[model samples]
Target: MKSHSEMKEIATRLKRDIIQLTSANTGHPGGAIGAAEIVAELYFNRLKHDPSNPFWEDRDRFILSNGHICTVLYSAMARSGYFEVEELKTFRKVNSRLQGHPSRHDLPGIETASGPLGQGLSIANGIALSNKLRNNNSKVYCLVGDGELQEGQIWEAAMTSAHYQLDNLVLIINWNDIQIDGHVKDVMNIEPIADKFKSFGWNTIEIDGHNISEIQSALDTFEINNGSPTAIIARTVLGNGVSYMEHEAIWHGKAPSSEEAKQALEEIGTSTFESDLIY
Candidate 1:
């Protein structure tokens, strides 16, 4: 496993990749940027899989329930060596496999296709249930946006995971507090979030999403002996790595222009070959 400093460095590079890939003024940037560290931690240190063979049996599965921020996932997967990093520049281009949202048909590392909100949890529940019945010890990790909790289906899935005692399942909520419309609190509050998860029979923990060490420790709790699933509500910034976009709702789905992307790369303090060549 990479050290906290190594993971933090990878996080910065992924943030740079996120901005560069979305530079065509398409795709979601705010949430993607905010969730970069969490994604990096999973892909680089926690996830159990071979980029060389994404379908390796016994490999841990990762589901992007809130798929709008897939740019981060794509970046992580690429950097993790699932594919050439150059492919990131094709993101959101016409007929590109790297569409705005994940498509399992085209992407190799993605476990499932996700775009419509609120359905990912149910899908994850089914997968987890299948693994349990098969006596498979493999784990499943899911990333969901804070605003996505408004979906009634998500809670329904949560209840199902707990009812089955799916201890192998983990849900990490990107609690950036902002959705596409506005502040999550103003649009629809999901506050008392951790308490709500606990009430549903889940093991809940809260942590600073950007703190690498804290994230690693919180995730390691998955090894704890427990009968219920776990929920880690990561408190994050909406546009974490960039000054202009941070904490702003309007930037949720807006891509940066060339100049804006340049500024963002400068803000993140890292540069990739793709960063200078992005559309």
Candidate 2:
């Protein structure tokens, strides 16, 4: 486990990378920023994978249901040594391995190609069931957007996971309360998300998504849980860490200009990441 201070620094650096990468390619920045801390925590602390062997069988799996926010995942993968961080600059470019959404074919670390929401949970269910059959100790972690809960397939997967008692799977909901169009509540209400999961037989925990300690505690709780799938409702800001972008839908799919990127970087601070590569 990393020290608290080290985790904080990692989160900050990941946040910076998210901003820079999204700005460079004009991809999804809002959700990426919101998910930075949790992504950092998972990649840096909880996940088991060898960068040297990208296809290690014993490695844990991560599925991003809300694939639009893959900018954050790509940033984490780069920093975690799956690939050179310099590749982040090519995000969303034509023929780049890093597309607008994650594709398992192009990226070695990505487990699934997800963009059309609500399918990730089902995919996770399949992987979890396979792990159970193989008696594999590897855990499957899936990240879904709050807006994604509106999908009925998610409920079916939720029920399947519970029925199979896939304790090796962890479902993380990025509860930023904002989506592409507008506020999640305005677009579609998913209140009592925890109760819904509990009804489906999942062990649910809610926490401050941006808090490293809370995130760490949630992972520990998942480890202790048995005979049921785990769900973590991570409350986060829509555009976390960027003053001008927080809770604003405009930044959802918009990229920052060079000048705007400079200003945002100024606010995020550059005195952190071990690597000096910040585009």
Candidate 3:
């Protein structure tokens, strides 16, 4: 098990990878950076996954619902040994397994092909239910964006997850607030998000998305089988580490230029990863 400090180092590396990968090609950088800690903690610390055996039947499933931020997922997957870390350079390139959005067929560890927004939770619900029926003790984790709450289908899936009492399913909402258009409230309010989940019969937990300790604590809380689905409202800054990008909607879908990436990388400092390759 990785210590909290070690997990934090991994998160920092993921953030660096996010900037480098997106800047090399074109991809969403803000949300991926924002979600770095959460993804890092899940893949390196909390999740029961086998990077060597991607199809291990009892492995915990992690579904990236808001697929636009796949830079972080791809980074975590490579760093954790699902594929070669050098493969990150191929992201968004022609015939690359790492695409703008995650495709389960294109990638070994991806649980679903997500891009249409809001559909990930529904798919997660089905997988969770199936696992439960087969008496598989594995859990299914679905990561969604707070902006994605605008889609009516998300709420429908929330109901489905709760109605079935899928204790094995965990929905993690990246509550960064910034979306492509603007702030979530300015665009479409999804406030009282936790209450809505509770109303739908879920066990809700709120935490700082960047706090690896708190993230681990919440996931630990979810492991006790409380007879309800779990929802973690991870409060985060849209562009977390870099000062110039934080809280800005413009960065939501914008990749940094070479100079911008250089500045961002400097601000993020160095990680243990030795790859000199930008991507």
Candidate 4:
């Protein structure tokens, strides 16, 4: 296990990578920025997976339901040794495995190809059920966006997971207020999200998504609570790390220019890449 400070530094470096890579490719940055800390915590501390053996049967699984935000997932995979960190710059480029959204066929760490909204939970349920039937102890984790909750399939999956008592499955909802169209409340409010999950019979917990320790604790707490699927409502800003992007829906699908990327990198602090002379 990495120390708390080491985890923080990894997250910071991944955030810097997200900003720089997205800016280079002009890809999604808002949701990616918001989810950096949570993803970092999971890959660096909570998850039990061997990057060298991507298909390890006993390994835990993670699915990115909100795939547009996968820039951070790709970054985490790279940092975790699933791929070369330098490949981050090829994001969204033609013939590159790292596309605008995640595809399991192309990427070793991605468990599902999930660009469409609201389907990841159902996929996670299937994986969890299979694990249970095989008497396996491996767990499944899925990350969903607040706006994606508007899809009816999410509620169906929620009901099914609880109905079958799939304790091996864990769902993390990125409850950032802003979505592409506008604020989630204005577009389609899923208020009292935690209560909704509770009503569905899920073991629910709410936490500051940016707090690494709290995020880690929530994952640990869920593991000890058996017989019910868990849901973590992680409250976070839309664009968390940058001054101009935080809480702003306009930045949802936009990328920073070269100058803006430089500023964002400075804000995130320097990394080993700075001295590598590889701009």
TM-score per candidate, chains pooled: 0.96, 0.97, 0.98, 0.96
lDDT of each: 0.88, 0.88, 0.92, 0.88
Measured by TM-score, how close is model 4 to the native structure? 0.96
Top candidate (lDDT): 3
Candidate 3 error regions (>4 Å): 273-279
Native RMSD of candidate 2 (Å)? 1.2
Q: Report the Cα lDDT for residue 68, model 3.
A: 97
Please tell me which predicted candidate would have the highest TM-score against the true structure.
3
Please, what are the lDDT tens digits per residue for candidate 2 over residues 221-274?
998848999999999997786789889988888888888777777877763556
lDDT of 2: 0.88
lDDT of 4 by residue, 46-124 (tens): 8889999999999999989999999889888988889887787778999999989999999887899998999999999
lDDT of 3 by residue, 143-257 (tens): 9999999999999999999999999989999999999999999999999999999899999999999998889999999999988999999999987989889999999999999
What value does the lDDT take at residue 193 in candidate 4?
96
At residue 8, candidate 4 shows an lDDT of 75
- The better candidate by TM-score, 1 or 2, is 2
lDDT of 1 by residue, 95-123 (tens): 77887899998988889999899988888
Question: What is the Cα-based TM-score of model 1?
Answer: 0.96
**Residue 76 displacement (Å), model 2:** 0.8
